[model samples]
Target: MQLDDALHAAFRREATGLEGIDVAVYEKYDRDPCEPIIGLGPREAPIGFFGRDPGEQEVRWGEPFIGAGGQKVREGLYRAIHGAALPDFEASREVGRLAFWANTVPYKPLGNKAWPMAVKRRFQPLMAAVLVDHWQGRELITLGREAFLWFGINQSRETRQALDAFWKRDDRFETHHDTPLQLENGHAATFRLYPLPHPSPLNQTWYRRFPDLLAARLESLDAARRLG
Candidate 1:
């Protein structure tokens, strides 16, 4: 009946087919295999962030977007809401609670590779429930190309085409656009999406500027007014 119940069921059906999963990564972090590794952080949070998937840090912390790249986004949010530096990673989880979070693939993959399209398609419906039925926010800051494009999954053909066209725009990352989504549960809503380059330290092109870009994205939401 609950979203977690649905996610676990789906994971159970697909677990055997989920290839390239680094089970060692989960074991290294002492993560429970039976526990579903996805969901919104705090209900009705003002901001929501969708990422490509979990990494070592996320598996260890048992929270999406709690890794290095996630920390960058959180620092920007902390600065926007409190006008002060977050001080340390010790507060990263609490800072992350300021918003809702999810990912394309809830679990990590081997060698940090993104999930294949078939896998994404298989889980798209469940992720849709997380966004449409669980998250109360009307907007999301999508990190990376995969995360932004995941919105097109399980949507109407028109919406898929529209999201693709929007991604082609040169200004896609600099501006926010509204996209409609429909879930199997009959939930339908349009969420404004602000795309941002993934903040992974290896992404030399945008890594350094990620914080500044995230600040602009939050300002676009008037995040200060709605949060902390």
Candidate 2:
């Protein structure tokens, strides 16, 4: 199946639960279509950020990764790949890698809010399907703890141990010595699973080194590809 079609199906399946939520407030406001919270492009593309909600008073655009955080993420991506403040997609396209973005949840939660654990659980499988179908079994570079947890890669005793070590050492990307965590679907993949602090302005300290970290990860991917 084409990745977009797969995503559409997965999103529909996952978002079925949203219909049951008390959307009375949303109904009071005009019911415009919820914009897609993910973007799918070629396999080699950079995946952008996907948040749970669009800002108030903003027109919902079709693509994911719009607004201030999107802008910062774009800037960071450009700096990482080309050492520039902005990426010229036309130029980047010539280098043979493209970028795509997706979110675990496809709809904006009520109150411009964080997703509930139950909601997140319902949505995660669809998100995983999108990742697996689109990336075709490639290792993922998840951006934050939420993404890691949503992708089902952060539930091991070893991972907890690693986090404990990081707490003691005050290191961000603490090593787990290759721990394996099982996903809902029972398919397993091993990843280095770097734990970045969230990129939100609320966590400005984490955002400072975000670009460099992403660049280094990209470089590692390149080196691994060469070795393979």
Candidate 3:
């Protein structure tokens, strides 16, 4: 399926599982075209980042990530990936590979509440399909523990052990800490998975090392490309 089609499917699947969420009064934001907030690249890059927004539903135009935590994420992506003081989405595409940006719970989280476990669980398969079908199994980079956990990698003791080892070693790529567990017909192999602490202000401790961690991950990607 095409990327848009796959994305829409995933969105619908996720939305359907929210029956118990009391979304009657909640406003729904229309899916807008993915635009670069900050440089010049293909209007259609395939890589993306997903998250949960814990606030109001109406998203402002020209703004992607929508809160302090989101701002920090943008900062991390900019400084770590683009080597910039602030994010320039246009410039980001020039350096690293990312085509799109999305969220599992695309709408801002209600009352700063965590997403329901059922909603998260139901959304994962659809999310995995979007990654596999649309991006044709391109590289993926997910931030936050929740996203990692949703991807089904958390169930593996080996993967958890790897993450722990990487943490203890204070490794750059943290290759030991995270492993690429395949999903949906080996789509997971197209890229690597880097699960860092959430960029939310709550996790300020992780921000200090964000750049270094991202840089190391990028280097590994480059190395893998060379080897291939």
Question: Candidates' lDDT values, in order?
Answer: 0.81, 0.51, 0.48
What TM-score, to 2 decimals, does candidate 1 have? 0.92
Candidate 3 — which residues are off by over 4 angstroms? 6-10, 13-58, 62-66, 79-83, 87-98, 153-173, 176-191, 222-228
What TM-score quantifies how close candidate 3 is to the native fold? 0.60
Pairs that collide, model 2: 45-98, 45-99, 46-98, 46-99, 46-100, 47-100
Writing each residue's lDDT as its tens digit, candidate 1 over 59-149 gives: 8888877777888888888899889998888776777776788898787888889989988988788778777777788789999889988
- Among residues 3 or more apart in sequence or in different chains, the pairs in candidate 3 whose N, CA or C atoms overlap within 3 Å are 38-89, 38-90, 39-90, 39-91, 45-99, 46-99, 47-99, 53-109, 162-177, 163-177
Off by over 4 Å in 1: 1-4
Off by over 4 Å in 2: 1-7, 16-36, 44-59, 87-97, 153-169, 174-186, 222-228
Better of 1 and 3 by lDDT: 1
Best by TM-score: 1
The candidate that wins on lDDT is 1
Cα lDDT tens digits, model 3, 61-156, are 333354555555555455554445764644433333333454555444445577777666555555555554455434444566665555453235
